[model samples]
Target: MDFGQIINLSLGYIFSPVTIAYALAAVGLAVHFGYAGLLNFGMAGFMAIGAYGYAISILSFGLPWWVGILIGCVGAMIFAFILGIPTLRLRADYLAIVTIAAAEIVRLLFTTQVFDEYTNSADGLGGYHAGFRGANPFPPGTYGFGPFTYSADQLWVRVFGLVLLGIAVYLVWALMRSPWGRVLKGIREDEDAVRSLGKNIFAYKMQALMIGGVFGALGGVVFALPSAVVPAVYQTSLTFFIWTILLLGGAATVFGPVVGAVIFWVLMAFLDAFLPALAAVGVLPITSIQAATLRFILVGVALMLIVIFRPQGIFGNKRELTFVK
Candidate 1:
């Protein structure tokens, strides 16, 4: 393997659009599990709804791309509320079970033969993003230094993604500092105490879930921008990756999830490059295929170590954690 190829490949993730999307999704998750104490195992579902909603709207309705995106956001909020309201009052495990099942249900629905006319099922949606890419401002040229570079479209996407990321971080920072955020923290600490203080605990929880789901949905839309709306992309594995990033960066902190997302993907890319080299050169005995599989195994072990040593995450306050169990 070429050393330059490995370095450049590893560095390519630094400004990856997918990284930004995951960062946004993790930020939303920071609100759900981090501060709101809600267990949303179906974040990927919200994302799928957002992705398909936007694509389908633009494809079928001839709406402006921005309007379609707004439609997607609204759809995600409504979907999250629909999923959250009826389910929030139940036990914590119920939310976990329901959300996870709900996610799969949504994925299947998208891929279901009945909706293929609208959703395109397994083939997914495309040609709708022409309007989106038509707005790119970058002139045709390779940009960036060394391992970090982007084409005109890619650069535009990252710029747009970073803007969204900034807005999300700022919004969460404001929310986490307000009285509403404090009540969320209170609920996380003890819903009973918050209820004793005359607050509507369920209402707050619903709002938290809805808002966080909005973020996830927006992420889904943005995440698919660089790619396509493949229904299979919205799986439990995506949610797991988001959670790992959330936990890694230190949940409950305003910037933790975003930071964690960048770090996690970057590290994963790095390992994907370097580990195979080590194995191939006899630094280790594993083959490239095994090396690839082992990357996730190592990441899982690292996450386990983080949880074992600091359940609150790198930035989370131990006192703010909600142990519903």
Candidate 2:
């Protein structure tokens, strides 16, 4: 087994655009469940809208990159509004049920043959990143150290993702520090109290949903920066993965998502690399394919341990974990 390759792969996740995208999505979750106490289980739906909306606008409608992003954001906000309207006034579990169903609906809609002209159905949409690449400022060349080198376009995408992540972290930090954020937290802790104080609890929940959905949408866009907008990529597991990262870092902390994303990907890379090597050396009684599946099992065990011993997460407070009555 090439240990050097394993280390390189693990380290590469530090600057990966995918990691940044998940971090951004997890940040949105932090705002929803961690701050507003909204149970939004269909986060993947927001991401799907973001990715599909942007790609469809670009490929089918011939919209520019920025316009495509705007369309996606609008789509996510609309979805949030629609989902929140009927369920936000109810218990948190209702929102969770509705959101998860809505997410599945969105994914299945995109997979239907009726919209294949635009959505490409199950195959998904691609070849829409030309405008994004055209806007790249970096000169044409490879950059970075051994095993970390990336071409000009790849580097541009990573840099762009980093900037977005930074903006998201700062925005969450600032929002959580404001009066509006305090009210959101109050809602999270005790919605009845905030409602008794004359604040429109329903409206606040709706606003929180919209904000978090927008962040998830932005995350989807960033995630699709280097790949096609595939419906399969926005499955329920994606939401669970984001939740893992959110809780792993610190659900309510500003930088927890970022830190958690780095750690999660690094550990994933290391295990993915090491397990296959062990299998190859006959120490493990599994094929390479089975080894790939085992990584998640290991990750699940680790997450179980974290949940049992440190329910507050790495950077979260015990109070933050008290989302229940």
Candidate 3:
């Protein structure tokens, strides 16, 4: 086992563009489940819509990349409104069921052969990044050191992803500090109490949903930036991964999701490299094939331990734990 390689690999994931995308999604989720008392199990749907909307707009309509992004954001907001209107008034479980089903429906719709002309019917879209890459400022060469190195295009994606993530974090932080944020927190703590004050709980919840859903959409666009927008990438498992990042970082903290995303990917990368190295050395009883799956098993155990010993998460305040089920 090369310890240096493992360390470098882990560090690489800590700053990965994909990790930044997940962090953005988890931050949006932190607003939904952590601060607004909403259970949105269909985050993947927002992502899928964002990615597909952006891709289709650029590919089918010949729209500029920025215009496609705006369209994607608007599309996600509309989806949020549609999802939240009927379900936000109901119990959280109802929202959860609707959201999860809605996400699956969206995924299936993209995969359906009827939309082959638009969506390519699960084959997904590519060759649409030319305009996006045209904006890259980096020269055509490799950057970074050792395992952390990246080509010019890859470096542009990382820089762009980090910039977007920083903007998202700042936006969420500013929102949470405003009067609107106070209402969200109040609703999260006690909806009846907030309603008693004559506040429109449903409106607030819907607003939060839209805000978070937009964030998820932006994340989806970022996730698809380096490659095509594949429907399979927006499965329930993606939402679950975002949830894990949220929990791992501290659900209620502003920076928790960002930290959680970095940690989650870094640890996963480390385990992926380390377990295979161990298998090769015969230090572990498992074969390389089993090691691939076993890394997740180890990660699951670690998550279980985190939940048991520090349910509030690494950076979460104890008071925030009250909001969680």
**By TM-score, who's the top model here?**
2
* Ten-residue region with minimum lDDT total, candidate 2: 316-325
Off by over 4 Å in 1: none
- Which portions of model 3 miss their true places by more than 4 Å? 323-325
Per-candidate TM-score against the hidden true structure = 0.95, 0.98, 0.96
Model 2 clashing residue pairs (backbone): none
Ranking by lDDT: 2, 3, 1
Tens-digit lDDT string for candidate 3 (38-80): 8889999999988899999999999999889889899999999
Better of 1 and 2 by lDDT: 2
What are the RMSDs of all candidates, in order? 1.6, 1.1, 1.4
Instruction: Give me the displacement of residue 147 in model 3, in angstroms.
Output: 2.9
Q: What C-alpha lDDT do the candidate models reach, one value each?
A: 0.87, 0.89, 0.89
